[model samples]
Target: MKSVEEADYVIVGGGSAGGVLAGRLSQDPACRVALIEAGGSDRTRLCTVPGMVSIIHTTPKVKKRFDWGFYTAPQPHGAGRRIPYVRGRVVGGSSAINGMVYVRGHRQNYDDWEAEGCTGWGAADATRCYKQLEDWEGGEDAYRGAGGPIAVTRSRDLVPATQALVEAIAETCGVPVVDDYNGADQEGVGACQMNARGGRRYSSSEAFVQPALARPNFHLISGAAAARVVIEGGRAVGVELIDGDRRRIVRAAREVILCAGVIGSAHLLMLSGVGPAAHLRDHGIAAIADLPVGQNLHDHLFVPMTFLAPTARHRGTALHFLGGMVKEAMHKGDTWFSRTVFDALGFVRSSQAERGVPDIQLHCLPWSYPSPNQDRPVRPVVDKRPALTVMPTLIYPKSRGEVTLTSADPTAAPHIDPHFLEEEADRRLLIEGMKLVREIMASPRLGDIVQGELHPGPAFTSDAELAAELPNRIHTVYHPVGTCRMGVDDRAVVDPQLRVRGVDGLRVADASIMPRVIGGNTNAPSMMIGERCAELIAAAH
Candidate 1:
């Protein structure tokens, strides 16, 4: 290979954590950092405009350009189907393509991490990091932060249907309509907060990576896919990169941080012979460290309950919304398009949930469809009639799956088996969640506008019927984590410091290091992890 390009720190994957680390470390001036991203630029409208999100995941041409579009191996318990897994391959990573919803998750999520032996990662520490990262439009409060990079704004310009859904949730779920669910209490209904500013998405690349690029000490290498971590004498030295027909190596003088999300991080570990020994040997890779690299994989799964709403109107609503979004895109300003598609969000406890903690999350969309397909090419097609879809999602799932290599080739996609709904408890909890959402939709406030149940209709009411039908209806919430889980146990791939066990000069940041997936969205927490990782490295240096 050609002479190596060297840096004080080499971070693989310019996603949430990588972007933040690169930005924070480069600020020191003395620390040279190199961020490697597999995807190209995220400068297109498809990555910036909130309304263009659906189009990015649906259109074949657009999807290929931005998304990794990994399909899971057939899920035996989930109707024996192969699920479409959408992860952003752009410079901003999934943060660019994800629904700009910004949720810090419950503080208990981090507390639990500390309880599980991840010291210095409690609720208090996490909150401090969050305050340091966010520039809230709501201004600084006891709980919220200000004057930071990420712009967090509450949903604005809500449509009538969304307002009704929010009201219905409070009335039927016996919860208050709190302005900020990310604040004092999470168990309530209200508008969602998004990672946006002035109608434009503020992805991690925009918030962190962009500024870091201006620094002379920081270098960004795009379109360079990491093949494996170079290990010598049980220490990670550098990374071998595959850039089309060319190959190169980038040396990490201090450390090698993997922020390549859950799947990508685990895949790279196995490719570098850092995973389960037998599994690596199966692919002809000599094991470097035998650990549970791809175990404890889990995620949130939601089932959509579509309802017909007379108030949503029978004609031109979807078209009118699209037209307005196009106009808003042209003007490059705030409009209804700037808001999340599902403006209303709620957190509630299921019947089987632990006291004072919510197990269910509800996302209410103002628009709906007769049939929602997960196939990448044909999805996101909305019906002309005014309809709403309330997705009742299980926030903390007990089900676990794994990520393993289908081949030794780094370019080939890894085998992702989410093993969704395999656990009886997850299946039971989701059914309870669905029942709770149905009650909210059936409330008097929304009952007037509602026509009828369109999907998993009224006829299927009993628990047995719902259980039988779950396999066909359930899908991922796009938050996969725990593949390279950090803890104090034998199964732990990384320790509390996020350093990969048995390997020196290597760490796995991002969602993969999460001992358990947080109760809410992963994007915000991923960024927080990035910030925390930077602090750790800085202090050590």
Candidate 2:
């Protein structure tokens, strides 16, 4: 045991949500806050590039330092293949290394949370928080907020295929094109709104953390891994951090906030003896409280349905490079290549006929997209040919999984069992989604542009074929949630205000607390959670 320094608040994990919370809480000036991050700073050039995210994914130098590099336990549903789970280890967390798509999801997704024991977290309640964090470049309205820290802009590098897909889907499905998916209605095809400005990535850390670093009340400690929450008599006191061979304990006078993400946050709670008693006993850790810490893991599973386009107009790999150049030249009033290459995109409900909410989501990229398991090409080969890639994601999965401690060590990654494709319905819906993608691509509007299906080829046209091929092709959308779920029920890990039911002065403020995963990209919602958490904590004071 070491002498601990006390602060009004101690926040674990200075990633997406934590960054916002730290910034907001320390704004009170009167309160001293300490934000501990397990990774280093986000000063790398790789993190700033909006179009080069895929390049970073394949590079070992960046991956080794910035990524947690976690892998799931062998999934029984996916035929025993271990799913790779990448979480951001840097100051911005996953937002520092994500695709940068800024989606708020369907409003009903949050309303459903209120229905499921999260009383004040309904769409109406949560949207305000979402609005507060965004500085929408498209301008402000009732749905979007202005003068906020996080810059949300439309992508500058939209490819032709993406625009074609949006137009095709709208014409074929009769789903009207929406200008903003984060607006009045979420179930439509339109351009994807992203967290980009001036052709650069705007992560939460960049938007929130960087600015807050100068505040005297705010203390940000990077490279400090929170080993466990220090609890005494069922209340969290602070946390223990491991630095080299030295252990340091820090105390929080007010509360110990856990924003360690779905996997990290839940693992810390369990390590602090806040999970299932039987499991805790087996790990040789005393159980302070028995709760379902990692019982309800959920994620959106996706299968890519690629298409080969006719003519050399598709641009393929050149689109990213050209898009960058067009953006740069456009800054200098050169619009020569602007109209020829578009970054247009859209989203639609997977099953529009059966829908109360959207089940499938689509993202179009103008390139010869490869699957996650595919090896990177050794050299950049421009196929002076047309190509397009459409990714169909299963948004609201019926299948559920769990995360378990492989070892009691806090540094060790947990066994994540997402159990993808376990439910027959999930598989059936995915097949339908794939067919929908094919239909959208084959629409009269896009038919003239596309040559044929490149993946799930013409040979495997039937639903049975899709079912057989999907298992081998499917990968995660990287939107895992519900592990440290929030609800009033016994199985719930935290309550409506995000406080651990059996414990005091501790709460989870991340995607893990989501009772159900949102309908679209989760980065925006995660930041909203952080913003909302700050409000909730401020109210508590």
Best by lDDT: 1
- Candidate 1 stretches with Cα past 4 Å from truth are 1-4, 313-318, 329-332, 369-377
Highest TM-score: give the candidate number.
Answer: 1
TM-scores of all candidate predictions against the true structure: 0.96, 0.93
Off by over 4 Å in 2: 1-4, 156-160, 310-345, 350-355, 373-385
lDDT of each: 0.86, 0.80
For candidate 2, which ten residues in a row score worst on lDDT? Answer: 333-342
Candidate 2's residue-wise lDDT over 218-257, tens digit each? 8888888999999998889899999768878889999999
lDDT of 2 at 452: 85
RMSD over all Cα atoms, model 1: 2.1
What lDDT would candidate 2 get against the real structure?
0.80
Q: What is the lDDT of residue 405 in candidate 2?
A: 85
Worst 10-residue lDDT window for candidate 1 reads: 369-378
